[model samples]
Target chain A: MKKHETAGPTLLRQLTYRLAVFTLIFAILDVGLVVWTYTSQPEALGEQLLTLEASKLERSPFLSPDELTGPPGARSWSARAVYPARANPDHPNRSGSLMDWTRRERLEHSIRISGVRRIERGGSPEWVWMELEADSIRPYIPVILNELLTHVALPLVPLLALMLIFNVLAARRILQPLRQAEREIERLDAEKMTTRLTEPSAPREVNALVRAVNRALQRLDDTMVRLRSFTSNAAHELRTPLSIIQLSLERLPESDHRTELQLDVSQLNRLVGQMLDLTRADTMEFDTGTILDLADIGRDIVSDMTPMAYSANRELHFDDFGSAMVSGHAEAIYRIYRNLVDNAFLHAPGESPIEVSAGPGPQISVRDYGPGICEADLSNIFEPLWRKDRRRNDGAGLGLSIVKRLAEAHHGTVSVQNMNGSGALFTVHFQEGMPESGDLKQTLPS
Target chain B: MRLLLIEDSKRLASLIRDGLQDQGFAVDWCETLNEVKLLRQLVQYDLLLLDLGLPDGDGLSLVRSMRRREDTTPILIITAHGELDDRVVGLDAGADDYLCKPFQLPELVSRCRALLRRPGASLSTVLSAGNVLFDSSTRALLVSGNLVDATAREINLLEHLLRRTGQVVPRPVLENSLYSMENAVTPNALEASVSRLRKRLKMAAANVQIRTVHGVGYVLFEPK
Candidate 1:
């Protein structure tokens, strides 16, 4: 999808390109129409030229016809004859000889008889016969083209440019809603599954697409709801029986077998609890309004788990650097530290102290002085159900994964590294500052 | 001591009741919240072990109603819903403590005992860790059935540590308990008292020992 988006032209570029293309097409069609009209109606051009010549003759009535007609061999106009009213009273200009003579001359020289005109120049009636050489009009072509350009094409250039600018702006205006929808979609995630795109005032096609996307989001939210409820129900159903078994086991007489069974039951219990926690971390949304102190939570968890650590022949320590305030759910953050400590207890050497510290910043770290993680397993340590020794029943390997998910749900990051000497240190960095209110809604399964 | 246990599951309820009885508590087992209302009228229970999920209604409603009427019987919520939100809600509804299900019976008994040991609750005034015991009413210390002599400050520190056995008690808490707000205390005052108490316990041959968690606090545990 990213490749295609980069490869395709943007809406503004496409609109400008198409507008320029159509403008060129219209300009070409306009020029063609002007040329065709002039060529198809040559008589109109002849009539216009003849009227201009007659007007020039009227301004200078004393000029001889020989001066008006150019030399014979030149490509120019010629005055065939000038007839007075008295010379032919009834139809003076309808003389057969004159007509025949003009026709013969036109055929011989390929001359065009422009027109015949009657005029009373200097108070005397007269008829004039005019003819022009067809080839002589070639010099006038540039003038006609200049006129057409000045009258039509020149004005259209600015108009076309204005249209192009308007088209680009209009295209951007029409797509504004779609850009808004894009931003909303970009912000969508599993936590904000309830968010939907809304663009009622967009164009018909874009609105249709927005509605379709909203419907898809609704379906996804429904699926998430179903999944969360299923997880909750499964947890309740499994935990009840496990509780009964644990209780029943505690009633048995003390023996090696009983202790082994009890150990097995407790391990199973931890696995179930961790699995549920993993599921909740995946689906739960944090309430941004809940402000918690990281240092306080760390101290509380270390204090709470001290008894467990003591029974395991290990010591738990907590270090607080004033109060580290952040926006998060208390229990989820507690779970993260608790899981890290639990992991440390599982790996650290007996009686070695584990340290849990909360911070100079919005961060918490747990360090265990034990055989540090191997280089190969460092990357996969947080993966669910990944155990160093698969045969061992000590842990179900879900604790680290739960820690990672819960940390992420609070907008935090988790990392692990081996100490310089002999230990592994796990650190979680939480985002500081209050999250935007109403960004997410808590939707826990009933 | 008498206690009321509310749970819906019969087998689990019976196991819990037996476990509590073995711990020397007269346990009255009921399966619903309605039976609890009727039982409360007849006998005043020292502690209430209420399960959040019951047949009649949510146990939180009962906790809220009990606290509303000024009844402070020290309700301990036992539930399979172990999510943090549920625990917070339970506590906010006036429950004294929360214990998620699938827990060992020993843990349940310890939590019950802890709640019952609150100042107003009707229970023995004796708090013990391993072979060492501290009587809150008489301010007495006993080790292996022998009385041990200790100063008032040492006994005060001992009582606080014994109350949270096998748990880390922060230095500030111990200091605040040892010296009142008006009294000025030196930085090493708590360490001095702890060392003195440690010597007394060693002389008395008490099994429990106070171990310091560097940069944190101290914990009292029985060495294996």
Candidate 2:
């Protein structure tokens, strides 16, 4: 049987994916802020330098020659003298003999200079040139970007890794009750209708599901109990009359009519017995701890059925391989083989030897050299109340169905196929497992 | 032999009573466990034929209580519930044997006889299988209501096999039962005795068969 899959979206996968996306968004936002702060620093610095110089010029008016000889060749800013008439046409204040110029010559030398001119007031309005070299600050944006990546984004890698590890553990812990519930549900069989799922210690949704399942199980159990009791009572009621009739018949003197009556009673009794067996096959639990040798069970069944076979002028040949151990209920296994043999005896022609065999695969097979089951009826043979030729009133057509159900109850399977040219072969294969010897009940008590 | 039959169905109980009466048993029929409990305290029954679904109460409870009070009467559960679980429960609750409803009269009588013949039972000495009966006290061998002549040694062999009907009795056990410990048994003495007894049973048309397992021993049971 295929195991049930936990389909649909899992909580763990959803949590991990959302968390990873949030982390990525935060990292991008942090990188954007760092780049914006570094790139804008140079422009703000240029504006601050112009304001300081303009304030200085307003305060001293360049008439104080000492101010004209102020600090020169500064690391980021420099000042030089220029005549007012030599100002470029692009200058905004051409009439006042003052202008700001961006020098192209400095760009080739890997330096960008921005000059702001202030005309000297004392002598013929000579311009004092103040220039700031942008490249001389050495690409601070790249350095700042590198620092942000190493100090901020790099640490998040390990954090995300830790989160993933913790998420896996949490997911497994959260799913523990669900996994347990799955196992419990899988183990539930018709025989165990009374068993309920241990109310899962899970989330609200899962708990609700568990409760619903438990309620369904409760209803099912109640129905089964009612049905079983009714069946039991009905069987008793039916058998009571039969029992009375059979007892009355037994008291009568031997006669042809009495013998015929006995046969009819026995046939009815067999039908009732098979009907009960069919019910039992559906509900019976196979005790796996009781392991028995298939060969031994076969031998016992054959021995028990020997007289019947002999009366019908048929032979039962059992090819025993000593111990073909299988884990199952002895009664159920015995019934399975008994039904097969009985079916063979009824359908198969009289006088043909029925061959029974067992092997190490833990498989027992019964073969008969009778007219093979029609190809169309082979599949439906195991269906309850189905028969190849309904004219044969010997059975209620429940034997094969019971055999199938009993085999499945023991975790085994039964199959039937036509043999070459003639007859049919029925085989039952038990699942393999070797429990402790003492754990298994003996097929035949010594 | 006296039996207390507790069955809810009046007709079924009556039928079973008549059958038991025909088998030379004194049967007292009741419809419920309450009546059985009352009647049981007044008179000790040799056996209790119980039906599970009684009118007043479950017969199993009565069986359980009887066992608790140390009542050793054999209980044969005759119930409509023929399920394996029901049978197991009845047996586990101290029932001597279990028979499903609608069982054959002969099978029921035979089961009753087997229970009565248990080693510790009061009716242990009377050996019976099918229509055959061998009473040790009377030293009589009867088949189908007819007295059959058999040697004492043959009777001994039949008694030994009958004691463990439907089960394999080892050769040594049969040999020992056939002769006293002081008597030296010949190599094929047991076999010869078994052969002679088998022939006599066949001649009398006894509804039983003796099967010899080559290396094991012998088993005797009524063939269906």
Best candidate, DockQ-wise? 1
The segments of candidate 2 whose C-alpha lies over 4 angstroms from its true place after superposition are: A1-39, A43-191, A194-209, A224-233, A241-393, A396-446, B1-5, B18-28, B33-48, B56-75, B88-96, B109-155, B158-224
In model 1, the runs with Cα more than 4 Å from the true position are A1-7, A13-25, A40-141, A144-148, A255-257, A374-379, A383-393, A433-446, B181-184, B222-224
| Residue-wise C-alpha lDDT for candidate 1, range A1-446, written one tens digit per residue | 12224468888788878887998888788778877776676655555555545555677888654466532333657674466444566764654222212321344645555556554578865556776665455634644566467656788888888988898888888888888888777667766577788766659889999999999899999998898778778877899899998888788888999899988988887887887888788766556347778888887888788778767777777888755777778899999999999899889887898999998778899999999999999888899999999998899899999989888777679999899999999999888765566344443321
- lDDT (tens digit, per residue) of candidate 1 on B45-150: 9999999888788899999998999999999999999976888999999999999988887778878877877778788889987899889999989999899999
Q: Over the stretch A1-446, how does candidate 2's per-residue lDDT look in tens digits?
A: 35666677777778789878988898888878766765576554444444445446656653442244322333455566665555566667776555654342345545444555564455545555665555444433335545576766788888987888788888788777787778778877767577788886667767888889999999999999888766655655678788778877887999999999988887787677777777777656435556678877777677666656655767777776555887777777788888899899888886998888787568898999999788788789999999877887778888899889888776678888899988999999887767667465322111
TM-scores of chain A across candidates: 0.71, 0.63
Deviation (Å) of A12 in candidate 2: 6.7
Model 1 TM-score on a 0 to 1 scale: 0.81
Local lDDT at A317 for model 1: 79
Tens digit of lDDT per residue, candidate 2, span B136-182?
Answer: 77879999999999988888788877876765566677888766743
Candidate 1, residue A393: Cα displacement in angstroms equals 4.6
Distance from true location, Cα of A130 in model 1, Å: 20
TM-score of each: 0.81, 0.62
Instruction: DockQ for candidate 1, please give it.
Output: 0.65
